[model samples]
Target: MTKPTTTPAEPPYLRIVAAIRRRIADGELLAGDRVPSTRQIAREWGVALATATKALTTLRLEGLVETRPRTGTVVAGTAPPTASPALPSTPSASPVSSASSTGTAPEQELTLERIVRTGMDIADAEGLSALSMRGVAARLGVAAMSLYRYVPGKDDLVLLMADTAYGEESYPADVPEGWRPRVELGARTLWTLYRRHPWLAQLGPISRPLPLPNLMVHGEWVLSALEGHGLDPTRLFDVHVLIYSHSHGLAVHLEREAQAEAATGQSDDEWMDSRAPTLQWLAESGRFPAFTRIVGSLGDGYDLRLDALFEFGLAALLDGLTPIIEGREATSR
Candidate 1:
């Protein structure tokens, strides 16, 4: 008799979490990679928003995904948990080298991946704020001027960084078996990648929609998802744009909170605590009864549940477009 191979059993949420965790451990999901939006997770895992949130929360607690200001939850790249442990204990100033210690021209040895990977390390440990031509050069122990040879300038470098990070995700090309499945998969793929490098959200809309060749497959996947929907080309464009906006809009908050924490070494809750006096004053004054009622719900303990908000809004948008989607399906058939 052949030996039986048994699959491991775990809860739905853990299974979902493990899927993400496995990617991270496998290096397929790199550092500074954005965690999937709760909506994306829910759709991918066929779980409820609450369960999805629990999965992301677990990742955040594990130091896997870090939220940054103007960015979203990004991969925490497995750098030393305590950076101080690795930083030079005593400072000594040496003229920063533009070339490696072996005296080889840094630019000559530079590959796109090398430049990007070094830059990512800086971003992961510090942040985008600390990333610049000179900063990345210093990290790589090369001359700041040498980085310019490859990067052209900081703006180009940042763009390349965003583009490179966006490449980490894999999108299925044949389009899923069903329109709904295809669309859900496309959105989840983009959202998962965005969750890794939330900074991509801040990079804004791509005017050409094909500037990043690597991301073209992703765009095609989204466009294909709308194929059977009764939407005209214009409406199809609008639908994809709407979904894209929703993901980035929520990501902006995640990025902001992450940046704030980095700057102050304080949690969002702590920052909110300092503002309590003002909030309390206003609440007690009762100048606006409606404001008081709503403000109470928005507390320091309150989180900007991006996933929940995304799901709620996405559902509403998709629901509202049902006639358009169904009409397209009917006409096609």
Candidate 2:
């Protein structure tokens, strides 16, 4: 049987849709087989719900799946009229029994596309530390060795997972009137995106980027925000890099706290209460009179409001950036 070749235009998610169609045509996804729900596909493919939904909807429209009474959406008994005529075939079309007889045909459906998706979800809910070939295979219900057929190593899997999550949203077609608004909007979007997959902030940028289309789009937008200031490309990119670094650097610790608290079943307040006596002892050391002055102002021991910290840092960054940006504007004029 000949294999299908992907075209330059084929997106990762659409490729997944085509692979699913092939599985249905080849009988691997038999009629009445429960198709994976959108959430599962998102987790499995590391694609966003929008991408997963689009793929499933494409399959549904093509007649590969249909909603049935007393059953959720499933593979239809008959291929939809719109299914590709050249849908690929697998061993399911002609069962093979030999030393090579794997339970499921080596369906191309289990492509790198699927591995990255599942890995992303694991990393998103847990953290990058939680993502592994063994973890992904467990989710796929396959032997750990089986995943080697897809992702090369845990590193490649993680890079792909990061890219897949980054592809979830699009930048605005046009920037707002001012750099302040544009940067604020863009930064907030990234913050929210990282918040959704809190592990994203923890992933280092050292690895070659995953050719993430959306992230590149965001880069273009950020560069445009600095356009009128006439900064060199390096400076423009540096500004963006520094701003995101500030946001994510702080967020990494925040997410770590969240994960730690969840695992240990201890709230921040509770943990701090236990540490209070030590903090008070340090405060009482009259050797540090200036430190005691501030503690007295709060009427309690050092109040560490992380939310306030994030806001204060954000405001300070923007305030500090203004002078530099104004200087560039002055030079440009």
Candidate 3:
């Protein structure tokens, strides 16, 4: 006997939306709680960014969630109430609130600094993609065009935000004793800033760095460390750039990990466990003998510790630079 055929699955976005809706209805997600970010949704569901965005848009349309300026997208204070059967409804005698009638605030005490700070807060919480003039206006209870008067455009506003974020911390008044220690301090300082604002890592690529003044301030710290080491101008600048790249290279993953955790609603280890099937397949494949041996030896499991990795790589990199820094030729040694 032949079995009956089942219907094809719903589209991915619809599935995601339904899942989030169920979570809300089940009390797993309370009002005003942050929902999974778009990047998070994409990473968690193994769907395209657009699909995750569409799911979020659908939830917004349904009034299940809202975008708050400094807080990203969160569950709406109240779900859109269900519609009841229409009776002979009568109009209300009282008038609606004046603020509600106009759909805007009567007066806005707007400022450039306020706008930039709002943009930074949004970027810090939700990431760069969630930022826009319109969103800022919505948060400020003003028209979107009003922001244009204070800030030229999104690009200009982003530059200001970057500078402000980078300027949060300052280097020491007196530099460290040794060149190596000074460089280490500078690198760690930048890493700490990135830890505070992970979204900073998703900025421009290495070749196209931002011309923000505060960024140059951090550069000065690194440059001063390598200055009196007898290296040529090109070599000094190159070494500084390489050191900056090392911090940034590892830093980018901080934001990605945050997105993943939010989307999947799981810790790093839990997420790794979800992918155990693939790991098992790779181990059994035996094609990669080295990889198989490494996994085989791990009776418990290997923990991917980024902080430890960073320290390890930093030491290795500085060790390799020791020869050049000490003005010693490898052939002579």
lDDT of each: 0.64, 0.64, 0.75
Clashes of each: 19, 4, 0
Q: For candidate 3, lDDT tens digit of each residue in 1-333? A: 999999998999999999999999999998878788765887899986567777887898898987653245778895333311121111220121222223454336666766666676566667677889898777567788998988899999988878877887788787779889988988888888787777788887888888889999989988888888788999888888889988888989987776765664444544565466688889898788899898889987797877888888888998988778768744457
Those runs of model 3 whose alpha carbons end farther than 4 Å from true positions after fitting are: 1-108, 260-270, 330-333
TM-score of 1: 0.62
Question: Which candidate would rank higher by lDDT, 1 or 3?
Answer: 3
Which of 1 and 3 is the better model by TM-score? 3
lDDT of 2 by residue, 1-333 (tens): 889887677776788788888887887888777677665676788876557667766777787776542234578785344431221122321222121123343444465656666666556545676677887776655677878877788977777767666666566666478887877766677766676667777766523333666677666676678777766677777777777676677767756766665453334443454455566788797777878787778764456765567667767887878767656446556
Question: How far does residue 237 in candidate 3 sit from its true spot (Å)?
Answer: 1.3
Candidate 3 residue-wise lDDT at 14: 99
Cα-based TM-score, every candidate = 0.62, 0.59, 0.68
Q: Which lDDT tens digits does candidate 1 get at residues 1-333?
A: 999999887878788878899988998778765567666677788876667766766777787776554335567764333322121111210121222222344455765556666565465445667788887776666777877667788878777776666666666545457666766666667766666655566665545443676577677777877876557799788878776666666776655566787674335543454455677788899798998888787653356667777778767767776667778446656
> Candidate 1 overall Cα lDDT vs. reference?
0.64
Q: Rank the candidates by TM-score, best first.
A: 3, 1, 2
Clashing pairs in 2: 44-117, 44-118, 45-117, 46-117
Worst 10 residues of 1 by lDDT: 85-94
Residue 241 miss distance in model 1 (angstroms): 0.4
